[model samples]
Target: MGGERGSIVHRITKRVSQEIEEDPNLVLINKKNADQADYLIGGGITSFDTYIDREKKDNRKYCTKGVFVSIRYQLVDVKTKEIVYTEERYIDRQDTREGSAPHAIAVVSDDIDMLAKQIVDITRPHEVKVTERIYLVETKNKDFKTACKLAKKSENRRKAQELFAKVYADEGSYQTGYNSAVLLFLNRDFEKAMEEMQAIEEKFHTKEAQKALKRIQEEIEYQQKPVQETSLDSMYLRF
Candidate 1:
């Protein structure tokens, strides 16, 4: 694969080899050595954007710089020459340096390294951590308390969301409404979460409700975006 950054092609080749070496099911070899292999992986840097402070505070001195790199990759059947998988991913890194624009751009090697690792991760997926909050029941109702316990077990998220919504509707407690919103978020219902949080904020006017509303709104915006499976051509056109 090729990239606009100096030595990026070499870095990518080295990084890919390193990643393959770490996987027990994969092996890295040259094209000539792939006669017995089942699949071939290939692709290149499809888009790149590097920038130094275009606006000069004094005599063209730059205070900020960054790079955005996008790479496209695919896995194909070596025998049939049929494409099996394709992906395009983008990485952006930026920093501030009190120096000339050229000097600022020279310190982007770390960004390139990070981009290379990201590409490797796309090829070999990595494990990520997910955080889940424990919702406490404030009501004296025995049934609501039992449902909260079931919700914490994660066996039935949809049922938990519905139960919490019912509790909030019957009790009209701000805490119950907040719990319902949290369950809605866990269920991947961003719009409903936002609605619940907004209602809580408007009625209670408390700092906690306002903060929760803000977080839910941010999650809603993130879910609405089309960043996943983006294309290099579309990214370039948008930029």
Candidate 2:
């Protein structure tokens, strides 16, 4: 809510209402106009922060350019006062050309609007595409091919993981090793994935291997975080 004349809260509310009105199953009547409704959605921006960095030329400060906008939001049922969703999002952009502080602030405001659109997408129904890969080692061994095929299937993950491990041990193909690590990651075996990727990094040291290793390390760190309870009380108390 703490924004310029084009407030983030107003932008988000207008966009969400427009999107909901387009849905055949939903209607958006103003609170004052409607006497009663089946449900009410209510929430506001909890926090809005912006950062701008000034460019430096030969140790002398030049013009401002880079900007970052972070916002925390929540959605709640007005009748029950229960929070249905909450999230914090950040957007950043940089421009090398000389610009004033107001120019950088304007860029950040645009980014906030874009972030609001993304939040609206989350509240609406949409389809998402999932991409996956299975490595194919150049070999005549039919068992290895079968394992690769099985590994691509969601239901046979465990069996496929065991088979891929066996293939990695026998063939010692860097491709197979990478595939094995990927399978371990998909199965939530982060430690094994890290070990396999680390081995690959030591021997091959390929860019692909390094990236995968970094990704697996991040996943391991994320999994180690403690789970927290989600409730309206927490949402209201946070700000």
Candidate 3:
């Protein structure tokens, strides 16, 4: 868990471990016997890029500061010795607080939680399934104007409506399609995932959609088979 911004990353990791400890559902194995665990989720902040500029208000300099922490990690399968997942992300925070550790944490707490959940979800994917399903259902039924109003009035009715929403056949809207594409990309189906992303880009015309398109395209290109180089000796000499 060492990195350029080692201390902050360590703090975030410690907090995440504390969360896992407090959570009833997660089974955290002892470090000594981590090899016996089914999967390993590990990450640390690789770099912290920060900037500050003065904003003059009332003839006084007020600094507008920001930091982008690039976190990198890999998930490995204990039994198979396979790298199941890897990700690099930049978590950005913009705040009035200057270059101080306490201020950094204050500005980035939410971002830390969000990123921590991502790693934790990899550690405990099953726990996130229900949450993902709920999100998907909400996405589907979000445009139901009158129905959404009525459903919000009663908890039971809302739950029932959500359940009913899940049963509807998906017409595959933008969010749903993007989610599906991401799942495919995660599963290493890059070609189909790229197709889905392209379709989304054509429809949404958003920067996020364009980013997804770029990522999948990069993955696809990177995964293509490389041409073996031939040395002069190999070309001239007989085996």
Candidate 4:
């Protein structure tokens, strides 16, 4: 490393190591801790993929190498026994070195580190958002048939109205807001989704609500960079 390395140098290494460690540890820990704690935990990586590009120097040229890795994961907590996390991590590793093998490794490693850190930053929050989403979905699905039946077949119209109202009025209202925000987020409407979330904060100041909203916002911002690339791909597909 040169000149004690820059701040980013440390970041790069710390990130890669952290990702490597956390990726595996989450699975083992969640499995081990599932029954013992107040919360049941489950985490696993379903898939991992990597891409690399290399340009060789002509003995007189500069070369650059880049790697991108994506990790897919799902995690659940037991007390609720609900999926609390679903997220993907994307990392980019890049190196620009003349012709040295050591320099090449250093560059690639540094890039991996940088990418891994980015992955962590993006994924952790996304996990929280997804978990909240799952909770909301579960709530909505729990009494659907009963609620619909009461709404449709109650002998007293007034009673049916009341039952229907009671059943569906606030069912997952908070989750609906959060879920709408998630769709907006996927559509790349970050600002509006955030504003929608702000209203949730104003209305329900619960810690869970706040945490859920915060997690969604963080993931939206984290994934924005990739969305740009995704947009380009979509355009190509359209053509």
Candidate 5:
């Protein structure tokens, strides 16, 4: 895999591997890990087309480039030797760009990323507990109250996160800020979490917030993957 087409092969493997590993029910392994990988995902470019529309106006040349790429990939159950899942994903991008070839290539990678996420969604999903401390401090902030209620159930945690973020914005207390960052971390929004943690450190300079920042950094180092899928599941009852 050396030519333009070959460039997509590595992207497909990498994107798919990362998304599949995010599933709490699956473990990702390669030559470096133990020989326990139970599924094989593979495929190639199913179809693609690229075109550059150029026009001359007054003396300057205008270019509107377009790219359409489709790739077909699959997940094969290794033990029983069966093709459990397969999908065809297509990406189209068109705009004036510095180069047409690179645009087309990037479109392929983007399409592969979308495909990988859909595969992750369809994989045998099992929810896992992610340990996080939500601040239940008595607050006048309505968002805080709503977050506490929503966080009681695992399925509502994502929505709870949005409210927690609002609480942090309204009241920049350490507890509020930490709660907000943990929600972002739980949702696997590491970049946003990092930003929020940095803000917390700058404002409060507290040790607890710093430690939370360190945990977030470790997760980023682990390839934007969660170290574990611990949950706030039913823990609100204890409080």
Candidate 6:
């Protein structure tokens, strides 16, 4: 798990172990119990990059920061010693702010849950049917109204995300800010979503945002770990 960022591998492994278990067919086992499991998931960071920029705006300094990470990993059938699935996943995130940049450690946080869930999606042999919905927020602004409509279309959601961001920036209201962050969370941009949610709480201190922020943070934490963990046996975490 050791790589450019000393602790990143550990974080990614923990996230991956927690997420991959979401697949109904798979249960993580301690790597020490390799003989007891049917498959294994392993990976490591291939490349990582970080950058920051600052701009002076109306006597205030605004900072923009970004992180890029690439990871290579594989899923192997334990008994057959065959590579079942493998991929080199690339993820990059940029945050432009009107003030201080996000913390250095926080900036480097990549969503390994995305990579792990991607693997689960690809490896899952069967599909389970489930119902879900993406809700829209109410806004008097015409642009916000348009965004609500655009969001209903799956592919147009990024466009909607941009609009939502604009509404949040312009209004700076709790409702707009909350909706913006919620959309990012739904889009799986956990880190940025967290940043936005925290901002809402800081500015409005509303109970609704506080509760939503807690739920978002908990999800980002993966129940503080997987639903089930076998301490002595070791859960399927590999780096």
Best by lDDT: 6
C-alpha TM-score for every candidate:
0.43, 0.47, 0.55, 0.32, 0.44, 0.47
Please report the TM-score between candidate 5 and the true structure.
0.44
**Which pairs of residues clash in candidate 6, taking residues 3 or more apart in a chain or in different chains?**
30-234
Cα lDDT tens digits, model 2, 172-232, are: 8787778778778766677988998899899998988888888778667644544343211
Model 1, residue 131: C-alpha shift (Å): 17
Per-model C-alpha lDDT, please? 0.59, 0.59, 0.56, 0.42, 0.63, 0.64
The TM-score leader among the candidates is 3
Query: Which residue pairs clash within candidate 5?
Result: 129-229, 129-230, 129-231, 130-230, 130-231
Compose the digit string of candidate 1's lDDT tens values, residues 1-239. 23355355456656666656676756665555566676666666676677766555766455677777666665555666554444456667677755654432245566656655554453342231113343574768765786676576444656766777787788887766777777776566778888888888899898777777776676665445433332221100000
* The 10-residue segment with the lowest total lDDT in model 4: 230-239
What is model 6's C-alpha RMSD? 17.4
RMSD (Cα, Å) for all candidates, in order, is 10.0, 9.2, 12.3, 17.2, 16.2, 17.4
Angstrom error at residue 24, model 3: 2.2
Model 3, range 133-193, lDDT digits (tens) per residue?
1123454355433333433332233343433334332454555555555555655567987
Q: Which scores higher on TM-score, 1 or 5?
A: 5
Candidates by lDDT, descending order = 6, 5, 1, 2, 3, 4
> What is the descending TM-score order?
3, 6, 2, 5, 1, 4
Between candidates 4 and 5, name the one with more favorable TM-score. 5
Indicate the worst ten consecutive residues by lDDT in candidate 1: 230-239
Candidate 1 error regions (>4 Å): 1-6, 54-62, 102-239
Candidate 5 displacement at residue 216 in angstroms? 45
Give the least accurate 10-residue stretch of model 3, judged by summed lDDT.
230-239
